[model samples]
Target: MKKEIIIKHLGVVLLLNGVFLFISFLISFFLNESSTVALLFSALICGIFGVFPLIFVERTEHISFNEGLTIVVLGWIITCVVGMLPYLMWGGEFTLTNAWFESVSGFTTTGSTILTEIESLPKGILFWRSSTHWIGGIGVILFVLLILPRSKGQRITIYNTEISSLSKMNFRYNTRKIVHILAVVYISLTLLETIALMVFGMNFFDAINHSFATIATGGFSTKNLSIAEYNNLGIEVIIMVFMILSGNHFGLIYGTIMLKKENLFRSSLARTFVSVLLIGVLLVTLKLYLSGTYDLLTSLRYASFQVISLGTTTGFATVDTIHWPIFTQIILIYFTIQCAMSGSTSGGLKFDRVYIFFKLLGKQIKLLKHPNSVFVSKFDGKRIDEKLEEQTLVFIVLYVAVFFATTIILTAMDIDGMTAFSASIATLGNVGPGFENVSSLGNFASLPDFGKFVLSVNMLLGRLEIFNILALIMIKK
Candidate 1:
């Protein structure tokens, strides 16, 4: 590994974080909130650390996969750690564990919060909270890749760490162009979402925060009740639309925007993702109505929003799924696991793999019947290689195994089975909420420190996807 490159990239992270902290300080200064000292101090510390690395580490022209992997993984870990400084120092509902949980949740774009009162936070700190989503949504590595005047090869090395294989399908551009496209799509969506929310009766602060959340699929609403606080169908609809869009591959969004032939509209995986989500919504709506939970209109209202929210791994809630019928909860859980498309802000086992997984399964079945048949599983006429199939299958198994292990560990700590299972799946899926004790509108603050730490690791693993992590670990081995 190139230690200098790792330090240099880490330095860039510190600088980026410092910029946000300075913004927070300015907010506190203007508003005269108690956060001024803490935020400013944090900014100074980050800036000093950032500059120290710059002074010591010389510039490099390229980075190997090992350095890039280390930077991405360590960058996330450090980002969460540094992100907690303000929350840690400000000290309200933010206990050390709670602060870490909240920071990790934000940076992971998971949207889970320890605060019962979202409106209770200062504007500056709240903006910082939402900023974490924006920064983390595109990925810390991608952000560095975007800004650093780096070569395509150098960017590709880091891009490998930031985005999973499935997410890259539509990104035919070289690394530099891809970065430009990602930035444009990300910024445009955020700006548009903010404007839309503002038009629908949200204040500028809340609008910006929610937009940041939406475009990032990071769902940290300023109101504790989330989008329900507005009670505006128009607002919810706009948000749902963007949530789905943001959950999709940015490459597709760029392609569509640039009027390229290949885009979200062209991808089979995108179609399947939407179709599955639609079916999930329809099923949940029926269950809710039949169970007498809500009338048809009300059921569709909440069901559609909640399904899309979780399906995209956005996690904004109009209604808590925990109190819904068991059947409804199951449908919601499926969406959570399925997640959004690859190459977008949303995390977890992306829809691309899930779609391919079934196709691969069908090919296996046919191969079984035909004996000596040569079968090729294809996605949108693109032949899926045997190695790709094996990789996807391994990811699926590891994804389930990790969740199961987390559940077992949580249950051993005297938690209920349902809560443990849901919590495990929620964090592993990078979906914010779970059922029962960790339900929508609930927080992970109550978890034991060790449990919280374990869950945080799961969040990183899920966001980064399993193989990149394994690859990084195996590099040393």
Candidate 2:
């Protein structure tokens, strides 16, 4: 498995994480905050462990698929482990379990929080939290691939393991170009959002942190009320715009910006994703309005924002969704299951798979009626092969099974049915927030320790797209 090579690659990820931690330390130092020592110690630990591996291991020209998969999975685990250090050391509400949960949630871009009062955290710690999202958004391995020199074959191996097959369907470039495109698009969006938020009266610090969370679609807001605290339509609009864009495939975004033929407008999947989100918004808006939850304008605003936020798996909330009508809650839950496009930062059973599942269902119905006739499934004007179709179907079943199993476990722990089921879907989708107890404004602190750990696993499964972890388990077996 080239264990040394895997460790060496992980060292690079650790180095990158150390760089962010050092920056956070500087922030803490400047602010004279109590977290300064914690950040420094964490950074030092990362640097030491990170540099030691490089010293013992030499470079390899090629990495096998199994090796690459191991590195990606282990890299994320290591990143999350290191991520918890600062929180654990700082010593407030962060217990060992809480630190791990919050760290995993951040790196997975799940946006779920164990902290009851987010605003009480020090500025540096908060920045570190948001930084984890930005790093994890494109993936730690991807960022390392960009900066480090590696053979094309080696890069391709890791790239394939890290990114989903469905996501790669839109990319026509080599692995190197794909990495470049991701980096450029990610950085550009983050920078632009920071500026836009600053222009809209957000302070520079908050602007940058929120921009990191927004562009990453990670949903780790600096405020306790999330986007609701601002209550500024302009800021909300800007965030919503970025959230939508971030949920679409980054390759498509780059294509559109560069005026390429394969842009978002031309992509069928992209069109479907946007259309579904809009429909969700409309349905939820109507339900909210009819239920007398809010006036038309207010309902539209909040509904649009919440629907897009959860639909995109960004999870930024402008209102407490628990008080909303049951109809609206169901609509939101549907979006939580049918997440944004595959290539985007959003995770879960992607809309592409859901779209394919429906198309497959229709094909099955046609076959049932026509008995002797043949029917084929197609997407984006191309014929879908039976293998990919089968894979999609299996993925959906597995996704449902995992979430349902999680729900059962949580319920066995004495959690309410609604909280357990919604929490399962929310965590499994890597979409933060749930209904009833774990609603938009509520926190995960009330959940039992074992429940938090199970949800953390769910977050990892969602972010890694389930199969990767399954493949890892098979490899181990």
Candidate 3:
């Protein structure tokens, strides 16, 4: 492995983060907030470390697969480390573990937080938190790739490592084009959402922050009650629409906007994804209404927002779902486990895998009935190769095993069964808010430090995709 190449690429990642940190510092400086010095020092540290590599190591036109993987993995780890600096320096409820947990949650777009009083944070700190989502939403490495001029080989190598095979399914373009599509869609959505939120009475700062969280599907709300604080139906409706859009395949979204043949309406996967979300909404809404939790309209309103939020893995909550009926909770849990589509910002056992799993199951049953019959599974008119099928099944099993292992570990720490189980899946799925102690309205501050650490690892695993990390390990061995 070319260690220098890895360092050089990783430097770019740091510089990208440094740029955001500087912006955050400006926010603090302008507001004369307490975090100004901390943000400035953190940004300087990132700049010094980031620039040191470029000055010493000459740029390379290419990097090997292993080098690319190392850069991608290390980029995230290092980014998280640097991400925690401002928080640690600013001080407050941020202990060492709490800072690490919040940083990981933000970068992973997991949205799980350990802070008990979120509203007390400085505006600069809050913007930095949301900035982490926007940065990590498309991916840190991809941003680096965008600015790395003429390094096609390096770009493709790192792009492949950063993006999953499933995510690439809808992206017919080459690496550069795919990266551009992601940036365009990501930026455009953030801008449009910011405008919409502003139109609905949110201040400029709040609008941009929420837009960042919403577009990234990372639910770090400025208010303690999240979207509930607004109490504006228009804001909720706008967020819900963007959440669902953010959860779909970005390539398909780009296609739809470009009026291409493979637009959202034309893709079966996209159609089914929306359909499933609607069905979940219907089920949860009915349960909420029938159980007298709310009137029909009220139930639909709250239920639709909650279902879409968790269904998209955005984690922005309109209501405290912990008090809802067990049936409704179960439905939400299902969405938590079966997260958003593959190519979108949301993570975990992607809906594509779940969609394929059932399709493959049906195919197997059909083959069983007719012993010699040939059965091939397909999605969106594309054939699912046998190897890809095997890989997806293995990934699902491994994903399940990892979460189960986490749940066991959490439970062993004396955490309750519901909290442990829900926290495990929620983190592993990068869906944020769990039940019980970590309910939609509740934070993860109550968990022991070690328990928070374990969930943070889960967040990274989900964000990186289990296979990527495991493959990197295998390569190391």
**Every model: Cα RMSD to truth:** 2.1, 2.1, 2.1
Enumerate clash totals for all models, in the order shown.
Answer: 1, 0, 0
- Tell me the tens digit of each residue's lDDT in model 2 across 32-113: 9999999999999999999988898898877666777788788889999999999999989999999999999999888999
Error of 3 at 314 (Å): 0.7
* TM of each candidate vs. truth: 0.95, 0.96, 0.96
Quote model 1's TM-score: 0.95
What is the C-alpha lDDT profile of model 1 across 92-146, one tens digit per residue?
Answer: 9898888888888899888877788778888889989999898899664366465
lDDT of model number 3:
0.88
User: What is the lDDT of every predicted structure here?
Assistant: 0.83, 0.87, 0.88
As for TM-score, the candidate ahead, 1 or 3, is 3
Per-residue lDDT value at 102 in model 3: 96
State residue 378's C-alpha deviation in candidate 2, in Å.
Answer: 1.6
lDDT: worst 10-residue window of model 1: 149-158
For 1-477, candidate 3 gives per-residue lDDT tens digits of 878888887888889899999999999999999999999999999999999999999987765667767777888999999999999999999999999999999999999998888899999999999999988887743564553343433434334434445556667776688788888898999999999999999999999999999988899998999999889999999999999999998888999999988789988888998999999999999999999999999999998999899989999988898899999999999999999887788878888888878989999899889979888887766787787678789989999999999999999999999999999999999999999999998899999999999999999999888877887898799
Model 1, residue 169: distance off in Å is 4.0
Candidate 1 backbone overlaps, count: 1
Better model by TM-score: candidate 1 vs candidate 2: 2
Number of clashes found in candidate 2:
0
Which clashing pairs does model 1 show? 167-343
